[model samples]
Structures are given as C-alpha cells and as structure tokens.
Target: MGFTTPTPIQEQAIPIILSKSDLIGCAQTGTGKTAAFLLPLLHLLTEANAGTEEENPKIKALVLVPTRELAGQIDQAMEGFSYFTPVSNLAIYGGGDGAGFEREKMALTRGSDVVVATPGKMLQHLRMGYVDFSQLQFLILDEADRMLDMGFVEDIRQIISHCPKERQTLFFSATMPPKIRELAKEILVEPEEINIAISKPSEKITQAAFSVPTGLKVELIKYLLSVKSVPNCIIFCSTKKSTKDLERELNSLDIKATAMHSDLEQVDREKALLQFKSGEYTVLVATDIMARGIDIKGVALVINFEVPRDAEDYVHRIGRTARADSRGVAFTLVAPDEQRDLFKIESLIEMEIQKVAIPPEIGDSPPFDEGNRRRGGGGRGGSRGRGHNGRGGGNRGGGGGRGGRSGSGRGRKPAGNRR
Candidate 1:
C-alpha cells in the first residue's frame, strides 16, 4: 500500500468510479487495475456504512472473477485497504469443505459489505435462494475477458439477473476483445472507457527466446537457470502434464521447484502459491492458471517452457516478472512447430523478441523460420520430435477446459494498442 503515485489506469479509472459512472477499464497485467477500482469503491462503501443502525447491512459491492485464486487475492487486497474502516468483506469461491461453505452462506445471508466470488460458486449459492442482492450498489467484473474465455457467459448472465439493474457496473479486463466488447454492451450502459498499454509487456522486462528442439526444452531451461542464477522465477507451461513433467525434470537437476495447476486441490494450490511468494520455492512451474491475476513481487525472471497458443497469454505469463517497476528477464523456448505461435506473439507485442542461440552442448536448435514452418506442416520437423507428442500442444484436453481457451488460430490482437 506504499502507493505514492497513481498509474495511468488508476488516475483515469478512480475518478470515473468515484463519480458513480459505469466504466470499462482496459489495462495490461502488472498495472494497478485492482487498486483503481478498489480504492474508490472502498471510499464509497465506508461513507455509506458510517451511521447505519441496521443489524444486517446490505451487500453493497460484489466482485466477480474468473478463478478462485483471483477472488482470494482481491479479498486480501480489500481487507488490507479497508483495515481502519468499518467495511467488511468476504471471498466466496469453490473447493471448500462443508464448514467453509456454511461460513460463506452466513456471510451472504447476513450481508457482508463487499463480496468477491467466482462465477460458478456464486451461481451455486444464488440458485439456493438464500443469497440476496436486493441492495447491491456496485457490481464489478475483474478480468472480464478471462471470464468469457472460460465460458462463464451464462453464469455471469444468471448472476447479473439477481442484482439490481440500476447499480454502477465496472468491467475491467487486460484485453478487450470483440466478445468482451459484446458482453460490455449487454451489461454496461454508456460506460467511460479507459485503456492503458493493453497487451504490452512491461518495459522493465528484457524479453528473449531460444529456438530449441522439443526434446531438449528441459536441458535448455536448466542451462539458462544455471547461467542466469535467477533467484526467483516462474516457468509457464501450456498444459498440466507439461507442468508436472518440467517440475520433475528441474528437480532432478537439484533445482527447487513447485507445480501449480487446476488438478491440485485448492489448499495445495494456495500452499504452492504461498511458498513461491515466501521464497520457499525458487521456481513455480504452472499452466496458464498463473498467467493472470496472481501478483507476486520480487520475481527476477519468467520462462515460457512452451509458447502459449493465445498470444495475449504470453503477455500475462511474462508479466509475472518486472512487476512494481522492478527490472526482470523473460525467456521463451520455442520449438519448430511452435514458431507460428511465437510469431503471433511478436506481432501482438509489436516488437520482435531477440533470438538467443542455444549452447552447443544442448545440440542443434530449430531454425527460427515461422513462415517456412507454416508452409510445410506443424510437425516437429525431424526425428527429434519424439517427446513432442507426450507434452502435447497448447490445446490438449484437460480438466474444465483449461487447455481449450486457445482461440482457433485466429490472430486477434489485444484491444487498445493503436499507438
């Protein structure tokens, strides 16, 4: 909370939110988008609850997010910001036991001042008819684009049907795609739009890539870690299997690493995140689940073990590093078949990433020709393709469509980057 200066998004958004106007905020990850909405909303809520004599205060603000991790993170932020105030908040999300569910029910029925929840869990409570949104004043959707990409449109619509129609609605997303725009139109009314460097990686990040064969990705990653001596790093994989496999390989090299994915229980995921943040784990191998809304400070590096199918995801993956204006490094290992994906990423970020040569001991690397690879096929290019199929591409089948968010080869750049 040592925020002396406002980020561009915060400066533009806080005013509009305080004015009680619906707003569409488009800002890249690592910006202060969360604070932009929360600070003003906390002010308004504290004012409204100053002298109320009611036993059960009505829920004033509800924040809907894509994942439970995000819900918990926002809830923590809300608690920190409103510590000296009388405003109370609760985070309701899935993967809890009966006691946790009961606690959430009590808070919802008796009205917490602010509530942050994932769409599915909130919808489950709403269906039970014990939850009430009669006096809900502010409705905020953080990571709106991610919610849509996760196929939460119907759940969102159902949840909105319960809230009052005359509330100030805020839609915040890192990328404002056409579908996000369509959803905004349906919910937001004449909202003031604010965009701040959408889809651009932080200038503090030194971005580079190594064109390596699919078989030697682990070797390349180990080599980089040893040479760079990165104290804190997050390695992003496109699938859970890849995440676990990479974690194992890194551990085999005596590197301390942990894996985070949807398959882990909620407690384990939280523990992994906590350990990573607390320096217990020097490296966190994860799927795209860690790409957005999970903010950790002092991360020295971020590595893309494989290129994300969605180009915008590349921005969020590398965004884990270089946060809070600190300089960091981002390295991506691109195989021959994944060259096209890397090209799309470069096109979206509007700058070609430097291609670093792999060390001679790691053997021959793939040619950095996305065009030629596209003309031929997406095959692994030679006999070195042995381990490629096991890890699978970006859109492999997995729990709850985690891999399916890879948009069907449509090169849609993130919105609001005209400059």
Candidate 2:
C-alpha cells in the first residue's frame, strides 16, 4: 500500500490490533496480512519509545516464521515501515554459514527492537545462550499453521515457554488447523479473534486437474506450455529429483525455468529469487516445503506437476497465483497412484476442480523411460544450461516488474506421502 489504499484484510486487521489486544488472523496470502500486523506493531513500539523516552532499547517484539524467505520478507517490510522511526529490526535464519549468522545475531542483540527468526536456527542460538527473550514484551507466530505442519511444534513450544507470560501474543496464518487452534489457546491472553473471511483459493483462478498416467506428465506439461499463452508459471513437484529433472527438461525445451529447495546454498537461493523476481526466468520448479513462504506477485499460473499430499498444501500452492486481486490459473496433474490424495485435497477445499483435457502429444515416451531421459536426470548434478544455475546471469525484464511476477527456487528432497 505504498501509494495505494489498504487491502480488505489490512483494513479489517490493522485497527483491531492497534487497540492492543492479541489477535488470530486467518486470511489468504496476498491479502496484505503482512502490513496488518506490521503497521500496528511498529506504531505500538514507537509509542512505547515516547513514554519511556530512552536512548537504549530491549527486545520487545518477536516474529517467528516457517522459512528463511518469509523471515527475510518480513524483515524487509519492517525496515520499510520503520524507515522514518527509530525502531530498528533484524531477520535471523539458518542456511547461512555459522560465522556469518553469529555476527548478524550479535548485531541484532546489540540494538534491534524486533527480531524475526526461523525455529531451527533460533533454537540453536537460544540453547547456546547466545540470546535471551525473557524480557520479550510481544510475540507473533506468523504462518503458525505452516510451522506446525513443518514439525516445529517442539521448537515453538520451547521458544514460547521461555517468553514472559504477561507478554501479548498474536497468531497469523493463511488458514488455521486444529492443532494450531490448540496452540493458540495455550499462548494467547484473552485474544480478540480477527478471522478474515477470505480463507479459500481465489475464484479468479480457473482450477483444473487431470488424471494422467505417471509417464505422461512431462508430455502434458510440454503440451500445456506449448498451447496456453503461458507467461510465467510455477511447477510443483513431490521430489527434488523431479523438480531438478523437470527444470532441466523445460530449459532443454526452451522454457527458461529454475529449481529451488533446501540443497542450494543461502547465497544461491537469494540470487535465484532475485533473478526470478527480475523476470530472468519464466518458471520456478519447487517442492511443497517452499509453497507458503514464496510471496511472488502476479504469477499467472500454478502447475502442480505432482498432486500435493494434503489439502492445505493445495490451497497454498494455488494461492501463489491469483494474487493481489488479479486473475490466474492452477492445473494439477494427478497420477493414478495419487487419486486418493487428490480426492482428499478436493474435499478439504470444499470444491471439485474440473478435469482438464490433455493433448495426445505431451509425452511421447513412458514416464520412467530411461531411454528418453534428459542428461543427468536424477539430481542437481545435471549440467547448468544457458540459464544461470544460481547467480551468473544478467537481469532481463519481462512484461511487468518483479513485484507481482517473481519466481523462486527449491532444493531437492522428498517428503512423506500424505497419510
């Protein structure tokens, strides 16, 4: 909302939080939820400064997110809002070398009024006595649902166990699950609920799913790329190997895409994100782990090369497209083995996506046909073609700016199939 007006989520949420009550906000991504909490948070902290009239500051606010990308995104947003004010902040996460993160943590310890962190890295620091939150006055669990889904409940519980009980707590998530609701009750103090009504995927996006034999997925993807005036899109895969393989195959077919996940170095992740945001690539191949944290704007399409294991994951993936009140599309390629998972996802979202017709020419070979395999099919060991693997590329502009059209990278790693 730089020069523009606030979104519905922001408008509804900002005022309620400004009253100093704890809140639970359930809204979709791209609804401006970030500003809803950030605005009130900054205002409250700045006002606290006037009352105390102090030159030094203690850690007053803590934001715990699920991923490094989100921590960075929130940190950047805080910096922008606190630009004119004296309230400074820092973002902390893992994936950086130990020494660099340690130095940054020390810098944060010295003066930052707010600290945003991921659970794993934050736990590492807390147990080693590198930082303390006993005096922490405010706590926020952004994307609380994702944290629980990522198996960080123990870490979150340990962190919150150390914070002052009297401190205010606010929990925000695109969607809330039963476990998150229980966790919210444990932490929040007389919380004022601010559940934003818009929790489902956008109606603007044309939702479609296709039940295809596993071998024909690549051919289907190729056919979709060839036919749909596909601008920039995201391809969701179940395995890192599939992600890397699909990316190499797409690039081989002149699709100009990139892969991102846990395996890439932090610096490379940052670079790949920047390039995608800058329109250096048209497609970003990734796994579901990266879904919630990827906040790119104006993504025209979301292609689930593999059906997600859970219904919630399906919502988040399609949420990447149809952002900022703009129109988008989502396609899912369901293999015969995944029919059950597909049914569960559709049931959770409470709507049936129409079946899409796949052209005959998409896959000419069997899905596991090693004979037709791209070079180095299984891992990142594949040669980096014309496109930059991580950092070695010049910025190339597409139709629009990166704000609404950025793509992302994901590392290769497999996760448990939905139970």
Candidate with top lDDT is: 1
1-419 per-residue lDDT for model 1 (tens digits): 79999987788888887877777777766788899999998887766555554446567778999998999999889878877666777889978588878877876787677789999999999999998776677889999989999999999988988887767888888766678777787777667777664556777999999999999999888889899987889999999999999999899999999999999988899999999988888999999999998899898989999998888899899998888968999999988888888877776766779998799999887778857435533322222111112111121111111011111111111111111
**Among all candidates shown, the one with the greatest TM-score:** 1
Stretches of candidate 2 exceeding 4 Å from the true structure: 3-5, 51-56, 197-199, 363-419
What's the distance in Å from true for residue 35, model 2? 0.9
Question: What overall lDDT goes with each candidate model?
Answer: 0.79, 0.70
Worst-scoring 10-residue span by lDDT in model 1: 399-408
Q: TM-score of each candidate? A: 0.88, 0.82
RMSD of 2: 14.4
Q: For model 1, what is the C-alpha lDDT against the true structure?
A: 0.79
Kindly provide the TM-score of model 1 when superposed on the true structure, using C-alpha atoms. 0.88
